[model samples]
Target: MAREPQTRAETSSSPLEPRVREALGQRLQELSYSFDEMVLRIPREEMVECCRLLKTTPGLDFKLLRCLSVVDYVDFMEVVYHLSSLSHPHKVTLKARLPAEDLRVPTVTTVWKGADWHEREGHDLFGVLFEGHPDLSPLLLYEGFEGYPGRKSYPMPEQRELYGE
Candidate 1:
């Protein structure tokens, strides 16, 4: 039989949960557990600072940036960062939501150098502008490619011509 989903209170019993909450403080919008890993949601404005703290904090040292990607939800876009602690058996998924009209967020490269390419990919595919990113050059797409192909609204070449997009 399958197990039931865990509620916030049920998952809060993990030893690292309290520490993560304390480290993030007011910046943390929501915290919960999924698939045995912690998930943190923070405002786009606080992403860079939050990432830095997660890496530098004493007990909750999330030193590894496992992945960085974006999900287009039609109305909004969600940026997800998977972070893991090398010294401890802890993993966290950090997320920030951006409005469709304003797809901009501060770069986490300042906190994790490995974010360079990931940021570029997000820019190329999702059209997210990573402010303070050293280079936002095309990573997966060609330099002159039109509309973000990764977005749900992106039109095909024939559709674009027919619709005058």
Candidate 2:
């Protein structure tokens, strides 16, 4: 995954349009932020810690959990969490991809109460179980549903029998 080179205008748009690259304490490290899209690419193992910091850090102030969902990419399933701040209105997206065989991630119910139904929705739609979720019951679908219906690989049953392809 090689990153594309930044153009002149892209390098100086809204300053918050894509990312504002700021030098870290260590010259070798820099913090990059995406303004338009709230995507963050932190290491998989550090996902929980990063979210914890975002919730507690004064300047960051990402106290609101806006959305949580999952997507399937054949071999893996991605769980995405979107957080926003009421004070600063800054937003961030946190994502974690787990193999289809083991689809689970750390729950943020402790950080944001809004995570309750969002985590349940993720589990209901993508079969992504959440660790420490307290309750993993179905939020939308009935209990006996065999599979997650939102998956791309899911087979759709024909309500109408017209076959004239």
Measured on C-alpha atoms, candidate 2 has an lDDT of 0.67
Could you report the Cα RMSD, in angstroms, for every candidate shown? Answer: 6.6, 5.5
Per-residue C-alpha lDDT of model 1 across residues 52-88, encoded as one tens digit per residue? 9999999888899999999888888889999999998
Clashing pairs in 2: 18-35, 19-33
TM-score of every candidate relative to the true structure = 0.87, 0.74
Worst 10 residues of 1 by lDDT: 1-10
